[model samples]
Target: LLQERQLIYDFMYKHKKTYSVGKICKYLKVSRNSYYHWKSVKLAKKKDSRRTVLVNEIKRIFKNSRQTYGSPRIQAELEKLGYKISRAYVARLIKAENIRFKPKKRFVNTTYSKHDYKIEKNTLDRQFKVEQLGKVWVSDITYIRVNDKWIYLTTMIDLADRQVVGWSLSKDMTYENTVLKAWNTARKRRQIIH
Candidate 1:
């Protein structure tokens, strides 16, 4: 409805010199009072001095934060600067100004290939699909933060069924706790007929 009003306003504005206001309003089926009201509101917004200042300040704060500050943080900063603004309003302004923030990536390096232990050969030759259960198994280890401490998780999956045959969680990444424990659990759960 607002868009239709805007289109009507634009059409009337463009053709105002050639056509009278009453005729245009009657043809468009809109009241002249509503058109005048919308024109007044738009002009008042354009004449607002605070909008320009706020946009500049918002851009400065966003740049100072290295483009990492989101709407909530930006709102807090604006409040600190004696401007009481809502987070939603700040977000809307940011979107209108085409401001974007970079998202922080959560990644942990769990694998360290440089070690004294012998590296095993790839026996599967990259062929992951298996014809039968227990024929091919894969394992992976990852870590999760728990209570400000890291807990390692190990999982063993059977390729045929694509199910987690065994899993283990430990505070340390030791072989006996992670890989060995998961392997022991897998052996107990499913028989390997090699």
Candidate 2:
């Protein structure tokens, strides 16, 4: 149907100056009003095509950013690419495309609070202010991801001067490998005066 309409419209366009529009529509067995309406809708579709192009560009930028950019950053990138798009419009487009940004992982919790093991009492009782050099020591274990594997890091710090007394890195989170290794290093570095 569209192809036939297009052919009739093209024929009318090519001979518009030579022939009348009513005579052409009558001979083509189509209404003049339908041709006029299709012409107007075709003009409107040109604007819609521009929007489609912008949507494609936005999707490309979003993917290139690893889907980690929000509207403000996306708008900045678009501006750098010579696209003068507003942040709100970019946000709307992102929402429409269902693009979700993944937040950077800052801290990974390795502690299991619901464990069945015994919980140690807080001996220091939040009194971090230590006067003597070897009065108090604090230790913590953290995990780091490298090459799709998690490695454990244990660090022992002297609370008095806030200095790292010892540290250990292990492929596993075993107590002997992590805490004991760091503790041994600290004992070797300085005497256990406390």
Candidate 3:
């Protein structure tokens, strides 16, 4: 609008006898008040064109970092290259360009306790706190979805320290699988109780 007003003002000044402010405003499809206001304000010099180049470099850095960097990181990277741009400037540039990084996906739990195999009663119940490290051992079996297929995993945890003493993963979730995992866990821990 300022540039259009400047052009109109220049044209009117060149031919003031024939063209008036009202006539120029009508030709430009702007109101007389707007034209007057634009005429009153002094036109400032155009902004530097180097900002576009800097913004492009910032965007390149963001893309190269897999779009994981935010304004601060991007500013730091720019500073490393001797670009003395401000963080606020980088943030404004990103906002004006509507550029944003994608968020990471959430981790999903894959435990499935529903099965036909006779589930042993929770012998340890919730009594996880034990006096000694090897006093009580708790075991549970879970299934993992790998490549759209189910893989069973059995783990024996020491109730005292909540440490996974033993674990076994298998394609089948049968009684043998559960027993084998328990046996392996006991063998690894050198526990006599079977």
Model 1 lDDT vs. the true structure?
0.89
Candidate 2, clashing residue pairs?
Answer: none
* Candidate with better lDDT, 2 vs 3: 2
Query: What is the C-alpha local distance difference test score of each model?
Result: 0.89, 0.85, 0.76
Alpha carbon lDDT at 112, candidate 2? 75
Best prediction by TM-score: 2
- Which tens-of-lDDT digit does each residue in 1-194 have in candidate 1? 88888999988877889999999999889999998997888778875667788889899999888788999999999999999788998898899999999875578575798899988887999898898999888999887867458899999999999999988999998999999999989988996745
RMSD each, Å: 12.6, 8.5, 12.7
Model 3 weakest lDDT span, ten residues long = 39-48
**Candidate 1: segments with Cα more than 4 A from true spot:** 1-110, 114-117
lDDT (Cα, tens digit) per residue for candidate 2, span 100-185 = 89876677565679988998998999999988877787999887868558998999999989999989999998899999999899
TM-scores across all candidates?
A: 0.46, 0.49, 0.37
The full ranking of all candidates by lDDT, starting with the best, is 1, 2, 3
lDDT of 3 by residue, 1-194 (tens): 66766787767656767877677777767778765565455332122346777788889998987787899999999999998989999999999888898664477766667878888787777776797867787778886767548888888877777878878888887767775766576666756453
List the lowest-lDDT window of 10 residues for candidate 1.
Answer: 102-111
Candidate 2 has its poorest 10 consecutive residues by lDDT at 103-112
